[model samples]
Target: MANDAIPVRTERAMMRREDNPFTFLQQEIDRLFDGFGRSFPAFAPPQAMMPRMDVSETDKTIEISAELPGLETKDVQLSLADNTLTIRGEKKSEREEQDKDYHLIERSFGAFSRSVALPEGVKAEDVSAEIAKGVLKVTVKKPAPKQSRQIDIKTAA
Candidate 1:
């Protein structure tokens, strides 16, 4: 009896699809930014370094907390102006290892800026910030509600 060999098929690497100008442009732009990120160690891609945040509001205060692991108070800046609360910071870290056969050093750096628009009547003096255990806490005191006063009509002079 003669043994028959089974046929095996292999697929090609390229798949056929309709050419799209917009897709091509988008892909090119993405590649550009990716290459730029790889070339510059100090600059991170957009939204890459955005810290996780939690915001809460009560009758008298708006509290915000951001998780900024490995960051210290000196590395962060907080400001309020024009009814906007801005948080800015730069993170720099380095690690070094030395052995008899090999020596290695690694560094990482990135900057981040985030802003939150405060509700009308929130003043800079009413805001406070504190940092501890790699977490940033911000408190905004809401302004007291103004009472409407009735005005009396005057006769023409």
Candidate 2:
């Protein structure tokens, strides 16, 4: 029994040593590099996901508004299929003059697609989408409810 206890304690001590802060950090760094290698064969850092989206819903409809600065309406596309609404677009920036140098280019210029699941009982035929002022708005209307009929009960004499 004592011999068994000794091995268990030794294993716990070894695990504690392996879990040291420096060792954990080194393991995390190795894991990150390994993930990067798997994700990017050319050893390039992974790009970040797009920013958050703003969605609004009312009793009658759902409205999705996305801020896409420097993007034209021609560059955007909206579609609905299989109860999923997808918004795809691209942002391209061109130099106005060849002699001018761009000191900073923080805006992203790439294709992006965002999809949202449509709720049940939504009227897909009544969906409307619009883009204005660099903001894309999608509206999906809810199905109209069935009208209820009043029932009158006769009083017993």
Most accurate candidate by lDDT: 1
Each prediction's whole-model lDDT (CA): 0.82, 0.71
lDDT of 1 by residue, 13-124 (tens): 2433336566788888999998875566556556767887899999999999998888998899999888889999998856556566864323345788898888888888
Model 1: how far residue 109 lies from native, Å: 3.2
Where model 2 places Cα greater than 4 Å from the true spot, the runs are 1-21, 24-51, 93-105, 121-125, 146-157
* TM per prediction: 0.64, 0.58
What's the CA error at residue 104 for candidate 2, in Å? 6.8
